[model samples]
Structure formats: structure tokens, C-alpha cells
Target: MHKLGYFYLPSGKQIALEISESTNKYRYSTNKDKVKFPNIESIIKLFDQTPPFDNSRNLSHFEQIREFTIAKGGRKGFTVYIYECEFNKMKEIKGSPFSKYGDGHESLGLKRGSRVIGRYIDTGKKYKDKYVFSSISLINDN
Candidate 1:
């Protein structure tokens, strides 16, 4: 198995993962914690990608907005909005995209207690959480 690197969680914990070159199966372990966590496949599915691997259709879902807070300094001279969201009523995670305009959340019409279909992109760095997405869009069901 080859190491793909670590997956960080919102709780500040990380999972070390290795994948088989031939089988593509993932093996993971947490850093000194024995807490039960999402399986490898589910964790992998949380990431959004481009063509061929763009499974946004399957991954994007209606996330109930719990609350949001505005923060500064994600990008140099830019503002970031940190959103607290829940998925499948099971997991609560923070999602945000660094914005030069400081209106990414407003442009999306996002508000507390609202539900919107959201897509995510991997930032490849630890932000508010391991699943921090670089961007999100409103999914039109029609």
C-alpha cells in the first residue's frame, strides 16, 4: 500500500491513510484516537472533482444551514465566511470558500435554517475542517 497522506477532521484529528496500488482499496487509522468515524469510501465521496471524476451529482445534496460566521484572512486581503452545516442529518461540518468580494455566502442566498444543494472542492489543506471546500453552488433541481 502507498500512503496518500492524511485526512484532517474538523475536530482537529487526522486519519492516516494508505491505498493499495492494484486494488485501490484504502486503509486508515486515526491519530491516537479510537473514536468511530466515517468509512473510507464515504470520506472519499465528500470530495468534489472535475470531469470523469465529477460525481458532484451524487455528492451534492441539500444541506441544512445551521448558522454562519464571517471571518477575515483566509486569502490575503480577502474575507472568508465560515458556514456551519449538517449533512444527511448525521454529520455537522464547516464549509467555506475564500472570497475576494467577501460575498460568496450572500451571493448564494445562504442563510441560517435554509436548505440548499451544495457541491464541494478539495482545498488540499486544512481549513476549518478536513472537508473544507473551495467553492459551492446552488443546485437547480428543475
Candidate 2:
């Protein structure tokens, strides 16, 4: 379990960010397994950088974020995993359209915990129905 950091929501609940690393280190392949997972020191530097997407509610992580400019400290190969009790028992669903983080990532309909709601992100534009992250500052200093 490559747990990196946790975030405290406005409601007091917590969200955690972890890296999905290849368990079989010996089997590691540069082509198949190569990720730049964020770290504490690097995370702190990103505090000033503009977010991948200012409006996270309308976009999924894959959609809202594309790339992060890191100064140092990151896993060579890993996956970013955001975990939370709120996501417990949560059913997997489809994410938003292509934008930044790209497709393949799942999006869920959530009504619990502290949330930032957004409207339809498509060209048609609909009413509020999406949930998004409030910030990218997931570093748990304490």
C-alpha cells in the first residue's frame, strides 16, 4: 500500500491519495509500468502552480488534470489512487469526456460527504449533476 497523503474535507471526513505500484518489482517494465506519483516536497511546490483544471466539479480527475510539473520526489512507476470512506461501497461508473486527464478513469455519482457540485460539461450543457474535488492539496503534513 503506497499511501501518500490524506485530505480533510469541510465535513471532517478524510480522502487519501495513494500510488498503485507494481508489487512484483522484479517484473517491472519501463513501457508497461512507469508513473510519476506526486510526493510531499513536490506537492508543496504545486501549491502555487495553477491547477490542471480550475473547475474540478465539472470534470473528473482524468478530465480535470493532464500533467503535473514536479520539481522532485515521485515514484518512477505508479498509479494515483484517491481513497476515502465516502467511496466505500461505491459502485463504479463512467467518467466525463476527454479533456485533460483523458478517458479510462471512472466517475461516480455521490451525494454524501462534502461535495463540490457541477453542471453538465458537454456542449449541450445541462443542470447540476457532477461532483468534483475542492483542491489538489492532498499532502498530509501532520
Candidate 3:
């Protein structure tokens, strides 16, 4: 299983966190699997370098995030998963305007446990709508 970690945010604030590894190690079950999945040590280092919004302690092992949820401004009636970027480099790749509108890697939404280096925003208008990590970015601690 591939190790992935996530910190939950409500109203742009960190509440709780969870760390887990995938049961299927051969490949990601979803299209958004390209995002890097970090192991235990990498997770800790990332947290230490970035620090948590809540200043709460870090998870000791991999598991599920049970204490965090979507904030009010978030998509009002949908479920969202938050994760940390296991890898540091995420560059934008242009694709068809119809990208993510068909099937397979082209259409599948972000995996429930997938990690992205960007922040999330909800306009309270849709369930499958949110922003992606941008090419013009911030937070470089490598």
C-alpha cells in the first residue's frame, strides 16, 4: 500500500489530521493518483517544515481522518477529502478543455485519499467544484 497523509481544514483552519497507506499498492484506484504519497518519516518532515494550522500533535501511524470536515464556504452538501502533497513538485499540464469530462484518468475526480500540494476552496454552489494547485505558487521549503 502507498502511504498518504491528510490534514483536515474547516474555514481555512486546520482541525484534525489522518495518515494512511493504500491497500492497493500496484496502482491507484482513481485517476488523481499521480500526486505523491509520502511515508511516515516524510509525513513528519513535511508537517514540521510547514507546521499545522492548529498546532496539534501529528499522527503516529497511518489511518483515516475522522475529526475534520468541510467548512461553511465549502461545497454545502458534498464530501471532500484533504491531503498533503507527498511530493514537492506539481506542475500544471494543459489538456483538452474536455479533460476530466469523459471517463478513466480523463474524467475521474480526485481520489478520496489522494494528496495535492494546493489549497481547496468551495463556493457553496457545487459538489465536484474546487481549485487545483497552481503553477504560480508559494511555500517552497525544500
User: Candidate 3, which segments miss by more than 4 Å at Cα?
Assistant: 1-21, 25-37, 55-142
- State which candidate, 2 or 3, has the greater lDDT: 3
How accurate locally is residue 10 in candidate 1, as Cα lDDT from 0 to 100? 24
Instruction: Give the backbone clash total of model 3.
Output: 1
Candidate 1 minimal-lDDT segment of 10 residues: 61-70
In terms of TM-score, the best-performing candidate is 3
- The list of candidate 2 runs beyond 4 A from truth reads 1-18, 22-39, 56-142
Shift in Å, residue 75, candidate 1: 8.5
Worst 10 residues of 3 by lDDT: 96-105
TM-score: model 2 vs. ground truth: 0.18
**lDDT by residue for model 1 (63-82), tens:** 11111111223334333333
Question: Predicted candidate 1: what Cα RMSD to the true structure?
Answer: 15.7
lDDT of each: 0.31, 0.28, 0.31
When 1 and 2 are scored with lDDT, the better candidate is 1
Candidate 2 lDDT by residue in tens digits, 33-117: 5554546664455444443344535544443323222311112321222222233222222332212221212334434222222
The digit string of per-residue lDDT tens for model 3 on 1-142 reads 1122334323112212122223344255565655334456755545554322232455433222322222322233332322123254332233412212121123235453333322332222212333233222333538
Ranking by TM-score: 3, 1, 2
